[model samples]
Target chain A: MHGKKLALKITSYCFLCLFSLFFLFPFVVMFLRSFFTATESLAIGSGLIPKVFYPKSYLDALDPDFLKYTGNTVIVIIANVVGKPLTAAMAAYAFVKVRFKGRKLIFYTAMCTIMLPAILTMIPVYKIFVDLGWNNTLLPLTVPAFFGGGFLNIFLTMQFIRSLPKDMDEAAIIDGANILQLMFRITFPLIMPVIVLVAVQSFFGAWNDFMGPLTYITDERLLTIPVGIYNKFFTAVSPLEAQPNVQMATGVIIMIPPIIIFCLFQKQLVDGVTFTGLKA
Target chain B: MNKNTKYKDILKTGKTLAALKSNITGYLLILPLLIGLIIFTIYPLLLSLYNSFYLDYDGFNNYSEFEFGFGNYIKAFSGYESKLFFKSVGITFSYAVIMVPLGLVLSFAVALFLNQKIRGMVVFRLIYYIPCLIPSIVNAIVFGYIFNSEDYGLMNTFFASIGIPAREFFYSASSEAVVTFAVMSLFGVGGAMLIWLAGLKSIPQSYYEAATLEGSGYFTQLFKITVPLCTPYIFYQLITSVIGTIQICDQVYVLTSEGGRDYSLLFYGVYIYREFQRNNFGYSAALAYMLFIVIAILSAILFRFNKYVYYEGDN
Candidate 1:
């Protein structure tokens, strides 16, 4: 048994080390790409690990769109922070705490909506936005968040609300606390962790969302980071008709703000994933 | 006894009405959510379902002019779109094949490494998570340079240092395209790592103590104990991954398939997306619905395996 244990430990260590390297290699490659030089490209041996390091990749990435893209991303994020979590929390509070006629039936119907793939709704939703004349506006981008339309948010809020003790709600009701008061005063404070979860998630969802902004926003001035990155690489009529390195530099810049935010909230994020029944 | 009886009797006459009041609050609570659902969601869903059954193209114009029938489904599954449908199904299948198992194994292994009583484990976990938060558009750009035909890639330089010939990793079966995607997916393994960590936390320390007393070593404890306990976690991650990969777009759409590589990187969701982009809405909805069906059927099959799962504390 002792010998077998020793062999197993070694195998576990070996497997773990190999896996870490596998997961780490792409980041390693991304890091190296950030440092590559044009001088090395002519070296016939110029590698991603530069013999000469230049800050220019970072420099080049900070273009005219840098501020514009960053500003747009920030606006959406702020809108999402205010809109997504609060709406979802209230809605979730309703689903869990409130009891009404046909309540279960209605909740079940909403839950069934969870399985309707967003891809299926893309065209019709876009058409609705277009017909409403909100297509080029951030209204299309940020408005649905106000009502807990994103079921994932609703689900997370449900989990948080489900975990709270029921007695507090009973006491509040005895004290004549309205549903809104019970939510804002009692339930919301208790589910702070989930609120944090929803905020961080909504921020990232709005931040990293390429397809949403791509499908909806067509104006140059209103371009979000994801769309900005694409425009940098794929712009047809521009003189810079697609240079890979410059585009990557833009990628480097685009990745930074969210990366920083994720670092700060990685703990909640991990917890949030597990707590929300992510696997199920 | 007096207070209890009085309290109980005080509300007796109004019991049904009070119950109705609470229920009304519940209805009111969900009112906003229901409204949004009807407008932004259910309405759109019905519209898509309606659109899918029609013939709508330039030879057809827009929604105002299109004729409704089973013609769209016919066009979708007919011989003309058969190759498109099958190719998409095949591509999505290949993608899931590479992604689901790969994500599970990689996430498991990385989770184990992080779980180890290693120095700086938190920082190490954080380092691994950086790529996941970078967003796919950024990921695509950086990788495009890293694998730009191997002529300018870091890997090529690394290979040349070892006397190996420079290779076009993308166009070849050593397929840089797939490699890029796999790399991108690895970054998002943070979610998976957390699940494994939760599983790790849920394990009773007493189990390890007992194993040690029986002269079992670390490996026996891990494989015989930790890994088995973690099977449920592994199973969950695998299922979500299977579903996620089926609807994958955006990363491939905004990233690679842009540069005349249309036919090459043509994924199922991406193919459907292009149909929409080209104003081929009818065709796109059909494909999206098909994806939904495939996902539902497969998830049901996987979910059936849930009976075998041994969740702790159930007994």
Candidate 2:
């Protein structure tokens, strides 16, 4: 029995290691190739490691045009990261603590929007933007975020708030705190972890959003990273097609921020996922 | 007695006024969300539904030429462009059917393994989940290059190293394209794996201990205790994955140029996008609605299985 158990453990480890390799292999290749010269990338029988490192590939990939795109992406991300958590928390607080008629109905209505796919509303939203002359501007991308950014964020926040003991609220109320004061002073501090979770999620969403920029931002100057990368790599029949090293380099650069955020907040992110799954 | 009655009336009115004030405060708190929902969600949904019945856009006049009575829906069903619509539906359906089950099983298995009390497990979990952090566009691009059929492609080179013939993946036949896409999507199973892990952790260890005492083997315990207990989570995953897979667009949009060879990879989302690009807004709206209905039906069917799910609180 002991020997069989040992064998099973070994088997499981082997399977896990193999699966990890599969998940990590593309990233490894992408990273390694990002430092390779244009010719080395295409050379036949070349080993995985480059013969000579070309760190300049990063610089070359982030030319002036790409820099502008990166800047645009940063603006969008900042607006989203700040706006989503702030507004979502407020909305979640209202749903959880504030008493009113039709509260459950309103909350459920917001939750139901999660089922309505974005593509279904793409056209009319686009028209709305056009009518408001908001196309080609960041408003089309960032303004709606000031509202409850996503139902998921609000719902997660509500769940977190619901988990907290109601006695805290009663204590604050007894101490002569108003509704806003109770929410902002007491409940907000308590749900900071979830707010961070929402911020992280919103940051990633804004950073990686391809369709939003693809549809709304028409000018080349106003393009975000994803759309810019698509145009740079995929759109043109570029002479750089042979130099996929540079393309990979661009991808690596764009991937860096999100990876850093993930590493920095790994615990919160895992906890967030666990919280969503278990609670839901 | 008159003075006392007047005082009582004043107290009653004060209480009513305070209630009204609280109600107003509640409304004020949720005002931003209410406005957002109306503008971004509710209005757009209604407009899209209305637009689905119209045909053609007058770009100069800034109005959609109305074609009443489901003309756009008919076009999607029986018009000349219906070929692409139907083909995309067939492709998306197969992709979802294959991808959802494959992803769930793989992630669940990974979760089971990771749940073991092994050293360096956190590192393994992070490594597995790193792919999920990468953007879908970047994921698609990286995979596209890796699976590129040409000479410099990684898959072809690896196959060559092992003395196997290289297969054209994305450029291959329809069935092959579906499999290739599904396989690429499996790279981001980390999210689902995390959920599964949470579900696994939530199952009480006492159940396993009792099973062991009763002479139940590991596999028996897993099936009898762990699997049944995790059904709620499994059900949740099923519904979400179904909804997500039905609306998949980004990867297909990035990987394929001009809708792949003979539009073989034209997914429903991509087809809707193309219709919009062609200024066929009404037809695209109809397509979106059709996709929505299909998702709704699939979700309804899956929700039926919720009765079998075991919740710990129920007992």
Candidate 3:
């Protein structure tokens, strides 16, 4: 029995290690190739690591165009990251704490939007934006966040708030706090962890958003990073295409902020995601 | 006695007034979200439904008058352009049929393995989930390079090192494109795995202990206890993955040039996008409605299986 248990443990470890390596290999290759010289990048049978360390690829990738796109992306990201949580938290607070008729009906209606895929809304939303003269600007991409963000964020925030004690609300009410004060002063501070999770998730969503930016932003100068990268590689005949290292470097640059955020808030993110899946 | 009853009636009215006041405050609090929903979600949904039945435009640049009927839907079903729509539906169905189950099983297995007691398990979990942290566009681009149909591609290089022949993935025939898409979907299995892990964690240890006391082995316990209890999570995964896979666009767009050879990789989402680009707004709206219907039907079917899902604390 002891020998069998030992064998099982050994096998499990080996399996995990192998799978982990498979998961990490692409990232490893991408990171290493980002440092390769242009010639080395295209060379047949070149090793994973660069022959000579090259830092110029990063510089080459960050031209004025790329910087402009990065700036646009940062603006959208800030709007989304800050706006989404605030709106979601307020909506969630209403659902959880407020004594209202038809609250369940309203909350369910909001939750049902999760099932309504974004594809269904794409054309009409685009037309609306175009008609409003908001197309080619970041307004269409970021403004909706200030209203309600996504249904998932609001749902998650509501779940977190539901798990908190109701005594806090009673305490605040007894202390002569109004409904808005109860939400903003007491409940918001208590649910800060979920708010952080929402902010991080929203930041990533805005940063990596392709379809929204692709549809709304038509001008080159107004493009965000994802659309910019797509245009650079696929749409236009940019000089960077021949330099694979610089392309990889651009990818690495775009990838860094999200990775850093993930590293810093992995626990809250995992908890929030799992909370969403299991609880929902 | 009449005075006392009158005093009670006034107290009751005052209490009802306070309730009414709070209800209005509650509505005010959620008013912003409700307004957004109406404008962005509900109104657009209704408009799309209406547009699907009409021909509103001539081409990409022309804005013609609308003829309200089922003309666009008829065009999508039996007209000359119907062939592409049907083909996209078929492709999307097959992709979802393969991708959803494969992702579920693989992610479940990973979660099970990772749940084992081991040192540095948290670190390992994070490492595994790192791929999901990479933005979708970047993930697609990196995978495109890795699976590029060249001798220098990462996949081809690895196969060659293992004495296997190189296989064209994204640039291959239709069947191989399906395989490539499935492989690409696997990269984000970490997200599903995390959910599965949470499901596993939520299962009480007492149940497993009880199973062990009854002389059940690991496999038996897994099949009988773990799988049954985790069915809720699995069902959630199933519904969402089906919806997600059917609407897959970003990766396909990034990987394929001009919709791949012979439109083999033209997914439902991409087809809708193309129709929009051609200014076939009504036609695209029809396609979108069709997608919505399919997802609703699939979800309805899955919900029927809730009978088999074991929920604790429910009699």
Candidate 4:
């Protein structure tokens, strides 16, 4: 029995390690190739690692235009990461703590919109943005976040709020705190974990939102990093300069913030996802 | 008696006033969300439905001067566009059909492995999930590089090292584009794997203890207790992922040079996007409505199957 258990353990470990390589291999190659010189990267037999650590590829990838695009992306990220959580938590508080008529109906209506794909709203929303003269600007990408963010964020915040104790909020109300004060002062601080989770999730979502910027922002100057990269590298028949090493370097640069955020908030992110999945 | 009646009237009025106050406060608190829903969701939904029946829209400002009544819908069903539209629909269906189940099963297996009592399991889980942290566009680009058809590409290079021929992955003329996409999607299985891990953790260890005491094997406990209990999450993941896979456009758009060679990768969502790009507002709205209907029907069918899902603590 002992030998059998030992064999099973070994097999499981071997399987896990092999699978880890499968997940990690591309990232490893991405990092290595980014460090290779242009000629070395194109050469199949030049080995997996760079012959010499090349800094020129990074410099070449970080053109002025790319840097500008990064700045635009940052503006978008800040707007969303700040706006989504605050608005979503406020909405969640109304649903959870405030006594309201037709509340269930309204909440269900919001929740049901999750099934409706965003593509359905693309055309009319585009027209509305154009009519409002918000086209070719970052407003299209950022302004809606201030309204209520996505319905999913609101729903997730609501779920988190539901799990909190009701006594705290009742005490605040009894002490003559208005609904807004109860939400902003009492509840918001207590629900900081979920608020942080929503913010981080929003940060990632805004960072990766390519299609929104692609559709709304026609001006080259206003393009986000993802869209700029798509137009700069992928659209043409051949990639710009055909320098795979430079492209890899650009990829490395774009991937850094998300990786850093993941490292910093790994626990919160894991718990949040687990909470969303299990609770929902 | 008159004084008592007057006092009762005041108390009743006070109760009604409090209810009214709470009602207004609730609306006030959710005002931003309410306004957002109306403008972004409700207005657009109604407008899209209305636009689906009309044509000749110079812009949203004037649709009254244009021809109206099922013209766009008819064009979608019968013409040159019809064939392309149906092909795209077929591709979307097949991709979703293949991917949704494949993702669920594979992630479930990974979760089972990750859930095992062992050292470094958390580290393994984190490593597995790291791929999901990277943005999809970057992921598409990296995968495009790795799966490039040339001998210099990563996959081809590895294949050549082992004496296999280079495979055309998402190349312009590649017929294997959909399959290649499916393979690329496996890298992000970590998201679903995390969900499945949550589900697995929810299953009681006491159940396994009971099973072991009855001399049942590991596989037996897994199938009997674990799988049955996991059906609820499996159902949840199924509905969400099916909706997701069907609407796949960003990856296809980024990877292919205009919807792949021979339109092999022209998904329904991309087709809608193309129509909208051509200023075909009515046509695109019609297409979007069709997609909404398809998803609604699919969700309804899945929910119908919810009877088989086992919920904990339910009789």
Candidate 5:
């Protein structure tokens, strides 16, 4: 039995290591190739380290237009990271503590929209934005976040709120706390972890959102990081051969914020995923 | 008797007033969400359904010129558009069929290993998760560069180093495009792995002890104990991933620029996007409805056949 256990442990380690490398391969390649000279980036077996450590790619990637795009991305992320959680929590609080006639009906209706494939609504939403003249502006991306946030965020938060003891709410009510006051002061503080989860998720969602920005914002000046990077690296109009190193640099830069955020909230994120799975 | 009746009526009116006040407050608190749902989700859904009937695209932005009929839906069903639509739908289904199971098995295996009490397990888990943390667009770009069709591509380079011949990936032939994407799906398996790990952790250690005492080996325990217990998690992953993979647009769009050679990578989402970009609002809206129907039916079927999922208390 001891020998068999040893064998199993060894096999597990081996498999884990191999899969780790497999998962890490693209990031490794992205990191290394970003520093390579233009030709070396395209070359086969160009060694792990670049012949000349190139900072030119990094410099080129930080051009004024790219910086502006970064700003645009930050604005969108901030709008969502703040708006989504706040509104989602408010909405969640309503569902959990507040007594209303249509509360169940409204909550279930909102939850049902969770199954609605985003593609189903994209066209009409696009038309609505176009008709409103909100197209080509960040309003298309940001304004809706303030409304209800998203159903998923609200759902996640609602679960968290439901798990809280109801006495806290009852006590607050007895103390003459208004609904908003109870949410902002009592429930919000206790549910900060889930709120953080929603905020971080929102940050990543807005950050990685390619299609939304790609659709609404046509002006080059207003492009977010994803669309900006696309026009720079992957478009036929702009040849991929122009700057492989720069493309990788920009890609690496774009990946850093999420990685840092992930590391910071790693435990919560993992737990949150599990929580969502079980509850959902 | 009259005075008593008057007091009772006053009490009744007071109670009703309090209920009305509470209802108003509740509605006000949730007003943002209610308005958002109406304007964003409900309105768009209905308008999308409504727009599918109209067919008029002459490059002008005038909605007044649009003719009312089912021409857009009909166009999608009977012609080259029909061929493309069904083919794209078929390709998407195949992609889902290939990827969902692949992801489940691979992520489950990884999660099982990661769940073991071992040194450096956290590092191993984090390494696996880093791929998932990479933004999808960036992942697409990185994969695009790494899987570049030419000899200079990173994978091809690795093949050369290992004495294997270079193979064209995602570019050479339409046959390999979907497969290439299915293979690329491996990178994002960390998300599912996390859920699987949660499922594994929830399984009581006593079950394993009982199995061990019965002289059941590792494989037996895994198959009989761990696998059965994790079925609910598997069910959830299946439903979510099926919906997700069917809506695959960004990766194909970002990687190939236009759905690869022969439109082999043009999944339904990308097709909808392309039509939308081309200003075929009615056609794309119709296509969007079709996708909605497909998803709804699939989800309904999955939920209907969820008897295989084992909840602990069910027995």
Candidate 6:
């Protein structure tokens, strides 16, 4: 029995190592590829290691246009990070807490949006964005998030809010606190972890958002990191000056901020996403 | 005494009115989201339902003037493109089948390991999540390079070293390119792992501690307690996995041969994109709506899974 247990432990560790490597391999390839110079990179192929740690790729992606793209990404993410959750939280709070006639119907309409898939709305939404002449700007990226509910976050916040004892409101009212004060002081503080989780999730969503920015923002000056790297990586029918090293660099650069964010909040991020009291 | 009673009643009515005023104020706070949802989200969804009924000779030019009819819907199923519709749907469903379960299993394994009380936990967790943060296009491009056919790709070199002949892993995923498709899917395990890590943590210590006291080994504990308790996260991952995979076009589009010889790896999202590339917006929209319907229907079906789901402490 002891021998059998020892074997199981060893096998588990081996499996973990193999799977961990499998998960880590692509990023290693990405980072290693980013370090090889153009000629050396083209020659070394997709080797596991670089013959020389050339740093030119980073410099290449640091162009004026690249900075502009980063700015564009930041701008779009800021809009979404601020807009999406505020919209979702307010909508969720009102739905779960506020008592009103037609509340259930309106909330259901919002909930139904999640399963609809963003595909169905693409053409029509794009058309309206075009008609408003807001297609080229970052408006297309930010504006929709402001209006829409992140069904997941709203559901999360709703769960969090539901778990709270409603007696807090009665106590607040006894102290003559209004609804705004109720949210800001009493409720918001209680649900800070959920709020942070929603914010970080939104940050990741907006930062990694490609399809919206790809469809809407066409101006070379206004492209985000994903769009910029995409253009450099392929010309589709024609392979114009493909820079694998530079593309890797851009990928690395674009990937860094979120990685930092993830690492910084790793503990919270992990625990925050756990279904604390969720239905299994 | 009567005069005092009437004054007290008046004071009570005034307090009741104040409560009603706060309720209206709550509505005011949520109004922007409602307005935006109506203009950008709600109306467009309704419009898709409307347009799916009518084929506009000039839907783009005169959408407001178009009359509603069911010709488009019927044609969608029995139209010339009906076979294509069914084909895309089949491709999407199959893709979801492979992606969802595979991602969940891989993620669960990684999360289980990472959740251990071990050294270098942070580094492994950080490294594992890196790919999820990378743009999908770049993931495709890098994988594209490694799978590049013509004996140049990393796969060909590695295979040759093992005495296997150089195979075209990208040009056509035939039997030769199957490895490439599997590898492509592996790059996305990070997203699921992060969520799984979250799930692993939430498996309250009581279950494991109790299992230990009962002398059950780790595997039994894992199978019985960890797996059962983590169903919420598993279900969440499964749904998103299905959604992501159904629209699995970006990597295929960015990485493989333009013609993608034999077209074995041509997923549904890529096919719609190809249509769009060919200026077939109407067809693309039609195709997209088909996916939308599948996702909606699947989710609705899964909503029934609530009966099986185990909410903690409920028993």
Using DockQ as the measure, the top candidate is 5
- Which tens-of-lDDT digit does each residue in B1-315 have in candidate 6? 999989999998886776677568657766866787688778887766666655532346455555456555555588555665565566567656776787789778778878877667788777777777666666766776677664546777677677787777767636345446766777678778888887787777887888899999878998999888877777777676777777776566656523266555666776666655554455566666777877888777776876676766777
lDDT of 2: 0.83
**Which whole-number lDDT from 0 to 100 does residue A67 have in model 4?**
94
Per-model TM-score on C-alpha atoms: 0.88, 0.95, 0.94, 0.95, 0.94, 0.89
Q: Going through the candidates in order, what fraction of the true interface contacts does each contain?
A: 0.62, 0.59, 0.61, 0.65, 0.72, 0.52
Off by over 4 Å in 5: A44-48, A236-241, B1-7, B56-64, B159-166, B312-315
> Candidate 5 chain A — worst ten consecutive residues by lDDT sum?
A233-242
Instruction: Note the DockQ of each predicted structure.
Output: 0.53, 0.65, 0.64, 0.65, 0.68, 0.52
- Tens digits of per-residue lDDT, candidate 4, B1-315, equal 999999999999998898899899889878888888899899999989888888645345478777889888888889898888888988898888888898888988888888989899878987898888877778866887788877678888889988998888887454588888888889889999988888888888999999999999989988999999988888889898999888888778888635777788888888888788888888889889989998999999998878888877777
Per-candidate clash tally: 2, 0, 0, 0, 0, 1
Indicate whether candidate 1 or candidate 2 has the larger DockQ.
Answer: 2
Global CA lDDT computed for model 6: 0.71
TM-score of chain A of 1: 0.87
Location of the lowest summed lDDT over 10 successive residues in candidate 3 chain B: B56-65
| Sequence-dependent TM-score of model 4 | 0.95
Give the per-residue lDDT digits (tens) of candidate 1, residues A1-280: 6998677667766765665676566666556655655444434556556676766877777777777888888888898988888778777887888777887777777777766667888778888888888877888778877865467778887887787789998998899988778888998899988888889888888888988888877787888888877776666563234644455566666667777777788788777766665334
* Poorest lDDT segment (10 consecutive residues) of candidate 2 chain A: A234-243
Q: Which ten residues in a row have the lowest lDDT in candidate 6 chain A?
A: A271-280
Task: Give one digit per residue, the lDDT tens place, for model 1 in B136-179.
Answer: 87666665555555554666766778987776544443334555
- Return the TM-score for candidate 1, rounded to 2 decimals: 0.88
**Predicted candidate 3 versus true structure: per-residue lDDT over B33-142, tens digit per residue:** 98898989999999788778777443334334677787877887786678888888889888887778888899999999999888878888988887887767677667
lDDT of 6 at A115: 70
Residue-level lDDT of model 3, residues A1-280, one tens digit each, is: 8999889989999989999898988788788998999887766678687899998989998999899999999999999999899888888888877789989988888878877768888889888898888996889888988887778888888889988988988988899988878878888899999999999999989888888888888788999998888887666453345477877888888878987898899889877865683543
Model 1 chain A weakest lDDT span, ten residues long: A236-245
For each candidate, what is the lDDT?
0.72, 0.83, 0.83, 0.84, 0.83, 0.71
